[model samples]
Structure formats: structure tokens, C-alpha cells
Target: MTTSFPDPAAFVGKVAFISGAASGIGAATAGRLARLGARLVLADRDAERLAAFAAQLATQDVLALNVDVTSMASVEQAIAAGIAHFGGLDLAVNSAGIDLPRCATAHYPAEDWDKVIAVNLTGVFNAVRNQIPAMLARGGGSIVNVSSIMGFRAFAGQPAYTAAKHGVIGLTKAAALDHAAQGVRINAVAPGFIETPLLAHLSEEKKQEAAMLHPVARLGQPDEITSVILFLLSDAASFVTGACYEVDGGYLAR
Candidate 1:
């Protein structure tokens, strides 16, 4: 069925909490939502970067906090601060994640495996666990967990990343089932390679090769993914939940 898009003002006066807000898709999403008039709580482990970015917004409606999503306590505190500051929460985006060194599953270092799962998988769990109550207290809310194309398919030498992303989709579905009837909608966005700071380390040739992997023959821009995320969080997607939206450049289709 066709659906009308939500008005730009749909999120006006709403409160949104975003993790990994210091850079990449998280930062882009925050800016877009803020422009739509949402009061924002931005969190990231990079305290300096988080504060600097939040300073650019420079409004009382914004709260910047250092949040280590791998730690339940850290996530809890950050959410609590947001709720206390804004008095309620209507939306959340769990975007804190890391990419570990590439290696075959058998050759992957156990330490890298632990760190990836901790940040990507467990981090989403912590956010969702803390966010649900805050959202419920506000009567209802929406959550978007950032997964990856690797979540559904696999790439050689990325066992840790693939496994963690796959777990995020599973977590998103399970959470949606548990909370859908209660008014909270949970879903995941599985993005293909996007041009973000995370890709800065790649060599020019490697970047080109990566881009060519997509049928669209280019990398996705951060704002492109942000648009999809904002739609899902907005009422325009009121019927969408427990699903994964791929914002790839048709990479998965190939």
C-alpha cells in the first residue's frame, strides 16, 4: 500500500535520544531530526567530539553525554539524563558500533570478537533495555537499530562484524515482538557501505572496489541513510515494525 510521508513538523517538540552521535550516520540523523524540531540527546564514547558537535547546535533543547553503550550502567545513565532533561522520550536510534580487523572466523582474534559483540550487539541491547521504559513512560515510542548489509549476508574476513550485525537484526525482531502490542515499535536499518569516517582508512583503490560492489556503482552518502531512518522513526512508518529496511545502493539485490 502507498503511504504518505510524514510532515517535517511531525517530530516537532518530540524528544529523540541518539547513540554514536559524534560521527557517521548517527550524527547525520541527529542533525536531520533536530532540524525537524526534535529535542535531542546525543551520546557517544568520544566525549570531546560529542560536546563539540553538540556545541554546533548550541540550544537548550540539546543534551550531550558520554555514553559507552557496551556498559549497561553507562547507557542507563545517559537515558536517565535525557529523560530528566527533556521530561520524556519519543524516539531512539542505536547507532553505536565498531568494525574490527578483517579475518576469517577461525583466524579471528578472540579479543576482537569480544569487542565487536560487546559494542554492536550488546550495545543495542543496552540501549533498547533502557529506552523501552522511557518510551513507555511517555505513552509510546519508536526505535531504530542500525544494522548492516553484512547482517543478512556475509563477507570474507569479517566474521566478527557479520556475526554482530546478524545478532542485531535478531535482537530487533525479538524486541519488536515483545513490545509491539505495548505501543513501542522496533525495527532495524541494514545499510550497505556508506561514505563515513569509518571508511576513511581504506585506500583509494579499495574504496573504488567497494563502491563497484554495489549495483548503483557508488557509495551511499550518510544523509541518504539518515532519510530512511527519519522516515522509520516518524509516524509515516506507523505500520512498520519488526522489519529490516535496507538502505543499500541496491547491493543486496545483487
Candidate 2:
């Protein structure tokens, strides 16, 4: 499907907070939104990388915060800093996540399971929990929680990641229902095998194998996923909420 966005200033004067903004999809989204005129709060655990990226953007329009999403206190502090800097927040995207070493569920390390759940599932809850009231104060806002195609389907060696992503979808739906009447819209985006820093360690052959998993015969790009996220955060998707949009290159279609 061809989509042409004519308005480059669709997000002008808007305040957007994005987690995991150090690199990959989050970094791509941050750049895109900034170009489209949105004031940004970029949060991530990688302080150096986050700072470098934020430095390239207009300093007056961006606040780079070092945040560990797994800790509720860290997330709260980041949100507080953003609000204090930008005055208010109008949109947010939760993209901080982690993947465990491949292993059967029974053989998975308890530590890995705990770490994954803390960063992925509870991390989203932390962001959402704090984001809601800020949006409520603004009278309305939008949120996009980044899930994965694995949220609905099973990956042989990703028990914790799968479970956490699935929980994100459920959380998104519940939040949508709870806030829609008050004008806050919550939704999710499930991306499939995107070419990001997460996959930078894969061998060329392994990357090809992953690409073949999608019917499109190739992996997706970060900007491709960013476009969908931008749409959800903008007024263009005013009627959208509690829905999970799959930008998976047909990976789940099969």
C-alpha cells in the first residue's frame, strides 16, 4: 500500500518521549519525528550513544536522558525531566526491550527470564503508568508500545521475549480502554526482523535465513517501522486505539 504524508509539520509543537532512543528503531523514530518538528525527549540506558545522537539534533528541541526502563524510579525521573524541560508531553513510544540467549523454556536461565521480563514487560508498565497522568493533565495524548510479531506467534527459543511482548499487547489494550474516554489513545506496533543494531552481530548467512522468514523476501528497515509509529502518534490516526499494527513484511501472514 502506498501512503504519502504531505504534511512534514504534522507533529510541530508536539512533545514526544521515546524510550530506547540510543539506536535502532527508536533512534530512527527520534530522527524522523524531529525532522517533522516534534520536540523530543530521547531516553535510553546507553548514556554516551544517547548523548551523541541528541547532540546532532537541535539542542533547544531535544532532551536526552539516561534511563534504565527496568527501574520504575528511573523511568519516573526521566518522565519528570522531560515534562520539566518541554513543559508537557503529547505522545510517547515504549521501545526498550531485551532478548535472551536461545534455549528451551525448561532450560532457560532464571536470571535471564527475570531480566527479560523486567526490561520488556514491567518496563512498559513503568512508562505507561507514568505517561498516563501527564497526558491526562494535557487533556489527551497518544502512546505506541512496541511489541513484536512474536507477541502472537511462538519463536522456538524465545519464551521470555514472547511472553513479555504478548503482555505488552494486553497492557496496551487495557490502557486504551481505560483512557480512550478521556482522550488518550493507546496502541502497539509489531515489527518483524528489522535490520537494527540488535541484528548487527548476525552472520550474513544467518541474516539471509532470517530474511527468508518474511514473505517479502527481505528484512524490514528501521525507517519503515518508524513511519507506522509516526502515523499512530499523529492526529492522522485519531480513530485508532487498542490496535496492534504489524509492519512485518508479511512475516506473520504465513
Residue-level lDDT tens digits of model 2 in 138-170: 999999999999898988888999999999999
lDDT of each: 0.92, 0.92
Q: Which stretches of model 1 miss by more than 4 angstroms? A: 1-3
lDDT for model 2, on a 0 to 1 scale? Answer: 0.92
Q: State the lDDT of candidate 1 residue by residue for 115-140, as single tens digits.
A: 99999999999999999999999889
- Model 1 RMSD vs true structure: 1.5
TM-score list, all predictions: 0.97, 0.96
Give per-candidate clash totals.
Answer: 0, 0
Q: Mark the regions of model 2 whose C-alpha exceeds 4 Å error after superposition.
A: 1-6
